[model samples]
Target chain A: MAEHEKITMAQAFNQALRDAMTADESVLMFGEDVGALGGVFRVTDGLTAEFGGARCFDTPLAESGIMGFAVGLAMNGMRPVVEMQFDAFAYPAFEQIVSHVAKMRNRTRGALSMPITIRIPYAGGIGGVEHHCDSSEAYYAHTPGLTVVAPATVADAYTLMREAIASPDPVVVLEPKKLYWSKDEVDLDEVQPGIGRAVVRREGTDATLIAYGTSVPIALEAADAAAAEGRSLQVVDVRSIVPFDDETVCAAVRSTGRAVVVAEAPGFASVSSEIVARVTERCFHHLAAPVRRVTGFDIPYPPPKLEHLHLPSVDRVLDAVDTLQWDDV
Target chain B: MPSHDFLPSEQPVQLLDQDGRRVEDPKRAFPSDEDLLRAHEALVVGRRINEQAYALVRQGRLAVYPSSYGQEACEVAAALVLDDQDWLFPTYRDVVSIIGRGVDPVETLTLLKGDWHCGYDPTEHRVAPQTTPLATQLIHAVGVAHAATLRGEDTVVMAMCGDGATSEGDFHEALNFAAVFKAPVVFFVQNNEYAISVPLARQTVAPSLAHKAVGYGMPGERVDGNDVAALLSVLGDAVHAARSGAGPSLVEAHTYRMQAHTNADDATRYRQDDEVAAWQGRDPLLRSKAYLTGRELLTDERTAEIAAKAEAVATVMRDGLMQDVEPVPGDLFEHVHATPTPQLREQAAFLADELSREKVS
Candidate 1:
């Protein structure tokens, strides 16, 4: 047994990379500036020096090439974990990912598999503009051959990454940039609750508030704010978007008889819409009112000064929760 | 460390001239009678299978087939140069190469038959499935080659694409990595002049596709794609260079697409019959047969025996493909991930219930 270690979300992620590399010799990590500079956010600091360049190296600044390279390596039995540096910056690479990475294993009828995990820091509130701050998880979630997961808590950052790397399907783990500095106690060696399921952050009965990645904290705070007003709220962090925990989400929505789905992406076509659809379909009879959504506007991610209106703020989440209508049909 | 041995000539190479005569070059390496005969037979069988597949597509027995009718020399020579330790990365227009690379006809054709993505086990033959999206698989070849180098395995990888595929960004990326890493791999671009209707003039403005490699700091060579013996020698040299870690080489095999890109495409829309006739005059099979006859391997009796063998293989392929394939009930529920998600499991169970008549669609 190993001793417990207090860590930040970023630190936990760093440890997760180290742990995965240590666990499997075939696990290779590479991306632009990931080696000598330890990643743009310093999440991979000391990995190159520790793991050596063979395991942890930097690639030329070409996302498409990086992903295609990973595709080949995975087919040949190496598990590659590539960092996209930022969320929107990963868009170019997703072309190779969608056309090849996602479909390769299925195309080969399981004779070949891509266990590559693409790690990207996503969402706004870090004050970075444009490509650095936009949330792009929905694109990956919509692709059939991909598994999408995000960690809201420090502990999940470690466990979900292990789970993502261990997954046979190609996975993209969207890490929230704003939550990077958020700290919590985590025992590196302890086996806590595993990943790929929704986690109830704070439980209550009046309504269920669902969110993931950067919105989980906002949902939790909203739950607290609603609790002060005597409106009990259940906060659920929806972790895996593709293989969403429909059972957990539906069960919480059914028990509470009302729901609010939240995300930092546009609501028209997003993880939030899918969650609302599933919760509405499964919890139709138990619902007290229409399921509400607190999401980013359909506009392109704006400058940081106006991001408060675009991001799912605590007030925005509570606003959605407040309009449950609670009237009998 | 810099580019080495790059010599892209203005004219395409032709070891066997137009009149079915050998063009003697004192400096070039040549093959033995056995290698030439093997190349000839591979071309013969590959064309027979290709012709059968074309007929099958027309008869509604096949979904699609990108014919390699006029490019058999490129197909045969590319495979003949590789040992069992090497990997062959090919494109969808490469059924001939697949057969030449030793993949079973039925297994290789299953994907084109609309039955599966790829029915054969790739690891068994070291041949990646035919990539349909242009030069996407080029990097995969380099990646595998790089991995092999890291593991100290002296395995070479041969990646084949068309003239149009060289226009793709993935092609450049593959060349860059192969040269930077000095991976043991060969980029065999069969310049068949057209890509699904777009002509070569529109495909690239470059003088030749082989010249694309010199910019990536690797040797690039051009070969006569229809001349099996010349293609065999050129690809053989490139394969040897790669296997010995001399770095990647690009060989542009100049040829012509004698048929429509696929059953869905009409070659008449973009090409002329006279041009096709001109290329048909230098058909890979005719030239190879002419060369094999000169070597006394294509004797009258042996020609009859080879035709009989090719016919038997075509019959087997037809029978294997014509048989009924039983798809498993839960085929859709399998292998989406190493472990299925809980929701996926629930959906699968729901599907099972529906199939059992307990629930309706």
Candidate 2:
């Protein structure tokens, strides 16, 4: 509890994993660079030194093998936490995720449950290559039997990680790559039950800006800027994608009369689009304008130089709020 | 000359003589009349279940039913060899094999019913779900075998797939993995002549599916799939080898598909009726019936009784189809995650509200 001093998101992640591994013998971790190099992102640093190779180790370079072996381990009463070096590298393992892990429990009529957590540092803004900076939470959300969650703050990251590790089903915790180095004060003394609820990062009366993962900070920044311009912008950081917090989102949108969903995933069939459609349906009578989405373009993740354009920035979110027809208000 | 190598080219075991006489192979353990009748009843049940499933598909009651019409003996033989504690990994067409292991017929139909993604649980009755993605379950079976061996449990994992699955990379990898690990799993390859529309020749260049096991350093045997006795004897030996910690063995059951791959698949485009007609002459059921009739164990009256009972069960299944469980609108979001994420919960609630409004209107 005394380690509550300011720490980077990576350090928080390392601590969360260490705490989980020490608390439960069933919690094992593995990935490619996880052993000797302590992960490419160093999110799993010092885990190997503390837990030894058996509890924390490196798998073959094959992502499918890592996931498949994890499925086997889970079936045999072991909770395995797998790390994908980057968001894009997790694609090869998608086969196991979709065909095996997600469906194993339901396929076996609830006889087998995959208590596997896949830690992926996702979304651009980290200056990574095309494959490394992918925001593919949409792919996992679309998959049945897999819980998709993205933590925006250091506290949420630390809390949600322990929850994900203890979950009886397969969970994908998408850690915001840009937030890895973002430092914040976190308390890891107590456990939390935030299974599927969005937190109100900022309360306001104007348009509600909905976002998750890396885009959460941009939405908060946009809200702050909106307040200076005399617009009371409410911001909601949607932590979970599968079982979304409709109550928080709808309540916020009902009061604001305007909603703008944001995400780093491509706009086409993106999680943001789903959010926009839901807001339009539930908050239509209170709407000052059609629900909008401030998200990445329909194209693939752009190069590092152009990622700023692809990702929804504070200015883009502000523009969405400003352009909304609020004359009725 | 029989040095126990038992190459596919060597003399294959036979029980029924060419003249339709009952002849017991001295080298094999003969099954009792009770066992043979049980096998016969299994074939009848398998045939009836396939017929009912196909009928349901035609009536718009099911999405697709891959009929296990022609491969009942292979399933029954393999299933009968397994003890209660042994595991069986079945492919899409193993409805009969699972049923032979005492799996409820209704539960087996869930795959066709499209109620579950994986369709069956392996832990219950020591049988895995019906694997639909070709030979993927073969590797899973190997892993299960490895797990059993690690626990020092004397159990055989019988993984069954079609001839076409032999060409899959997973099948080869599984075979190689099992051989290297010395996993106690029997690889049952039902070489039912064609894989979907692809003939065995196109599926594999290897002389025989069983012979492919030689490359992996495992024993292989080719058997007359129509001859249930031969299949039972071969699988029984393989199962024993696995249970005794003798490593893996591959059994290739040589048979033919009497029906189309599925109600959706048209065999006319790929195969000729002559091929079908030729295989029809070698109907496994007829040979078994001939053996039974010659020995005075069965009669036309008993056969009629079996058919009547099967018809009654089919009627019951058809009558039970009145319950149309239209999926609940928000249920799709239920199992995706143990707890739907905050975002999905919002969508589910939104949908619920939308439906409520529609109901009020």
Classified by CAPRI criteria, candidate 2 counts as acceptable
What would the per-residue lDDT of candidate 2 be over residues A1-329, giving only the tens digit for each residue?
A: 36668888888788889999999987889888998799988988889888887788875466765676677557656788999988899887787789988888756656788899999989889887778899998899888788889999888888889888988998899999999999987676655447587888999988899999999999999888888889999999999886677778889999888889888788888898889887888888999898888888888888999888888889999988877887755
How does the DockQ of candidate 2 come out? 0.24
Residue runs of model 1 more than 4 Å from their true location after superposition: A1-5, A327-329, B1-4, B350-361
- Candidate 1 achieves a global lDDT of 0.86
| Worst ten in a row by lDDT for model 2 chain B | B1-10
Point out the worst 10-residue segment of candidate 1 chain A by lDDT.
A187-196
Q: What TM-score do all the candidates reach, one by one?
A: 0.96, 0.80
The positional error of residue B73 in candidate 2, measured at the CA in angstroms, is: 2.2
lDDT (C-alpha, whole model) for all candidates: 0.86, 0.81
